[model samples]
Structure formats: C-alpha cells, structure tokens
Target chain A: MTTSVSPVRGSRDASARSGLLASRRFVSVLGWSCLVSMALLVWLGLSVAPTDAVQKDAQRLMYVHVPAAWLAYLAFGVTAACSALYLWPRTRSLHYDRLAGASAEIGVLFTALTLALGSIWGRPVWGTWWTWDARLVTTAILFFLYLGYLALRRVPDDPQVRARRSAIAALVAVVDVPIVHFSVSWWRTLHQEGTVFGEDRDAQLDATMAWILLWAVVTFTLVYLFLVLRRYDLAGIEEAADERQLERAIVERRSEAASSVVAAPEPVSVAVGAAPGSAP
Target chain B: MTDAAYVIGGWGLTAGAIGVYALLLQRRLRRAVRSLPPEERPPWA
Candidate 1:
C-alpha cells in the first residue's frame, strides 16, 4: 500500500496569493473609473466649457497636454518611491523592485506623450514645434532619464542584481524632476512660467476656466493611478510564474534522483549474471 | 462646424484614444493571467 502526500493544502504562501488577488481587483476598479471620469471630463471641456479669448480654439490642446504632463510627473514620483524601498537594507523587497520597474515603463510612455502633446500645442500657439527654452529642455532631459532607467532594468539576468542596479539608477534620475520644475523660473525661457498651481496671480485665468482645468487634472490623475496599478499587477503575475517554474524544476530533479537510487541494484545484478557462464 | 465643433472633435478624439488604450491593457492583463498555470493564477482570479 502506498500513501500519497496531499499537495500541501493552502500552505504555499497564502499571503502572497491573496495580495496578488487584491491588487488585481483594485486595478480593475481603478481602470474602469478612470475611463468613465475621463470621458465625462473631456465632454465637459470640449463642448460645455468656454474657450480662451487669446488662444481661441487651439487652446483645446490644454485638455490633453496638461493631463499628460501631470501624469508623467506622478508616474516618476511612484518610480522614485519604489526604488527607495528597494534599496533600503532593512526593507529590500522584491515587490518594491517590481513596482519600480513597472512604474518606470509607464512613466516613459506618459513622458513621451507629454512631449509630443506639448509640441502639438506649441506649434499652434508658439508658431514653432520645437524650442530651446529652459522648461522644454529640462523636461526633455527628464523624459530621457526615465527612459534610461527602463533600459537598465533589461540589461541583467539575475533579478536581485538587476533590481539593485536599477534602484540606484532611479534614485539618480529623480533629481532631474525638480530641476525641470525650477528651470522656467530660473532662466529666461519662451515657455510661460508656472501658473496653474503656482502663486502667480496675474497668470491665473478666469474662475470658470480654472474649474475646468481642475476637472481635467483630476481626471488625468485617476487615469495615471489606474494604469500604474494595472502595470504593477502584471509584473507581479510574471514574477509569480517565474517562481513556480523554478519550484517545478527543483521537484523534477529530486524525483529523478530518487528513481535513480531505487534502480541502482538492478543494474548490479544484471552485470553479475553476465559475468561468467551464468547465462549459458 | 463652428469653433465649438472643433473643440468637441479634439476632446472626443482624446477620450476615445484613452478608452481604447485602457481596454487594450485590460485585455492584455486577462490574457497574461490566463496563460498562467491554474495553481499559479493570481488569487483574485
């Protein structure tokens, strides 16, 4: 009679299993809400809101450009936070490393979108698609820095080594974000100085337009959160799959070893039987 | 179409793009999860 061991019921790291599920649910809800809110906000901005007297219809680009820039900043901040968590000796966690990698990928996407949309807006309003102004140059540099961070994550095969190196790169790259923000104020740039969330009273627009801009900001923020969460969940899934593959390989090797041990005596007996005139 | 029409068109296009992208992301996530082994599937599924 053979006794079989039941496959370790619910003992295989339940916490990680549950956490992944929760993350998946959270991402789903966030993503759907973002879609609905963005749709409504766009409708309000384009059809119901009043246009600017100075820029006229072209000002509509604000709906897309501002949101893209805002999301880019938010995504980079997330990457920095995750990277710090990954690097801390007492708190070095693979979860944080995965989060950092995922957020950096999304950050690059939003940053590219920001630059492209900004260019589109600038062409119509500034009469040029490209500028050498302080704000524009700083922002472009920030975008490239995150791109470098993403590329770093792909270079190494060892997960722990890759995480450590990428964390260092992310920490160094975050310094550019602040520099980008202060560039417009520190230098004479064709780009307008900070106005929307700053203390520049004269640069402020009318109250209604401000409200519309606020809605746009909120909508874009929701969308960023949604995308980041989704990306993080996907990363978690991939990590889990890799772990399982490793576990399966280990089990297979052990089983092979046990079978070889059990069959060792049979080969010895066959060799002894064929030694002299035993077969004849 | 008036100036308002242009504004509406622009906003509509932006919204549509975002919506499509989000949907595509959802589909990708689902496919990835499905590709995982039954035991390894994320707990939420």
Candidate 2:
C-alpha cells in the first residue's frame, strides 16, 4: 500500500515560511532600534557624563557593569519561565525550549562580564581584585548554575529528554537569583549597598546619566531579544534537518528491501528460461 | 600614569572585552547557520 505523506510536509513548510516572513519586519525594527540605542548610550556614558569625584574614572565601569548584571538577571528569569513552559506537556513547545537555551547562553555571558567588570571596579576601591564577600559569592553561584544548565542541554541525546532536563535545571537555578539579590542586605560584604541613582540616591540621578542608563538598558534588551530569536531560528532549522535525515534513511531502507524482493524473482525467471531453451 | 588614567584603562578594557565577546557570539551564530544544509535553511533565512 502506497501512502502519500509529502503534501502534508510541504504544507507545513509553506506555513513556516509565511510565519517567518510575517515576523521579519518586527525583527528588523527591533534590531535597528537596539543598534541606535547602543550608539547613544556609548556617546552619553563615555563623553557626555561628567567624571565622578569619588571613584573617579572607575565610575565609568558602572555604565557597563551595572547594566550587564541587570541583563543577566532578566535573561535568567526568561530562561526559567521558558523552561517551565517546556516541562509542562500541555504547554510544551519547541519554541520555548529553544528560547530557554538561548537565554541561558546569553545569561552566562552577561554574568561572566558582570564578575569581570565588578572586579575591575573593586580593585581600585577595595584595594583588591578579588573577594569572597556575600554578594560576590552569590553572583558566582548564580553564574555557575546557568552554566550547568547549558551543559545539561548538551548531554542528552534525545531532544525531548534534553528539553525536559534542561527545564528542570533552569527552574532550580532561579532560587539563586533572589539569593544573589539579597546577599548584600543579608550579610556584611565588600560590595556597596544598592543605590537608587548614585550609590544610594533615593531621589534621582543627574538627568544625563539617567538618560544614558535608560538607553543602555533598552538597547541591551533589544540585543538580547535579537540574539534569542536568531538562536531559536537556528534550532528550528536543525530540527528540520534531523527530520529530513530520518526520512531519507527510511526511504533508502525501503528501496533496498524492494530491490531484494525483485532480485529473488530474477533467479526463478533465469531457471525457467534455461529449461525452455533447447540450445541452452 | 595618574589614578584617572588607571581607572579609564580599567573601564576601557572591560568594555573592550565585553564587546569582543559579543562579536564572537555573533560570529558563532553565523557560522552555525551557514553550516546548515540548503534544504534545512531556517525559514527566517
């Protein structure tokens, strides 16, 4: 029995193509906005903002370091949410799994940057490059948790198995986030207490610095989204390739089986022809 | 060098490191996408 399945697959491909086209404009707009915002942030932070009286030029690290840490937390939160969605069978979606993977990767990068930059800032003020203070230690733990999450995804052979396990890891890692945040409050630490604007300003920051920070946050967020979307798209392509590979293998096996069946009848035909031919 | 210079250098190096890392990631993503077979090209691509 010949079962035709090609049309269904073709239609699925067509739908995916149309969906991509529909989202293209949105992605481009967000990407450009991110680029523009990053430029503005660099200009304002490096040029327009005044040098600090206390930390002096080292204060400049705030522009990058603070934002990097914030983005790391944001990315991890998204990872946890996506992982949860993936774990629940009713809400399970490859999109969510791909998003969790992308977020974990990006979050790890930012977390590392936060530590590096924090150390740079700390060296000048704290008279040392490294410390095992509460905030610092908790941040390190948070970073490793996500690193483990990324590694877990790489270990499993089956996609569904990877997704489920990674999702659980993502969820468990989220507990570290709140710990990282409250570490300064909970314990005496070398890291300064959280500030509203400038190292504990309850009111507002200088208008220019505030603007720069706002733009920086916006730009980084857009950049994060772009990265995640690109990564997710790559995952989808990989899945399609895997499916195609399987289909090709099946087709090849079936063709081989048919050839064997055809060959079996060929010997009988040869015997009949030989018997019927007197010359033979 | 003055203290101001040291501070600037530190922040500058930090920024440079992060920027380079970002570029590396973008490159990796591009390579990954390019390595895919034509039939497996992402719908977005």
Q: What TM-score does chain B get in every candidate?
A: 0.83, 0.78
Write model 2 residue lDDT over A223-254, tens digit each, in one string: 77766665555555555555566667989999
- Per-residue lDDT for A74-174 in model 1, tens only? 88888899789778776676677777887787777767776776776677678887888888888899988988888888785667788889999999998
- Model 2 earns a TM-score of 0.79
Worst 10 residues of 2 chain A by lDDT: A1-10
Supply candidate 2's per-residue lDDT for A161: 71
| Model 2 alpha-carbon miss at residue A97, Å | 0.8
Candidate 2 regions with alpha-carbon error over 4 angstroms: A1-22, A197-201, A204-207, A253-280, B1-44
Per-model tally of clashing residue pairs: 1, 1
What TM-score should be assigned to candidate 1?
0.81
DockQ of predictions, in order shown = 0.40, 0.32
Judged by whole-model lDDT over C-alpha atoms, candidate 2 comes out at: 0.71
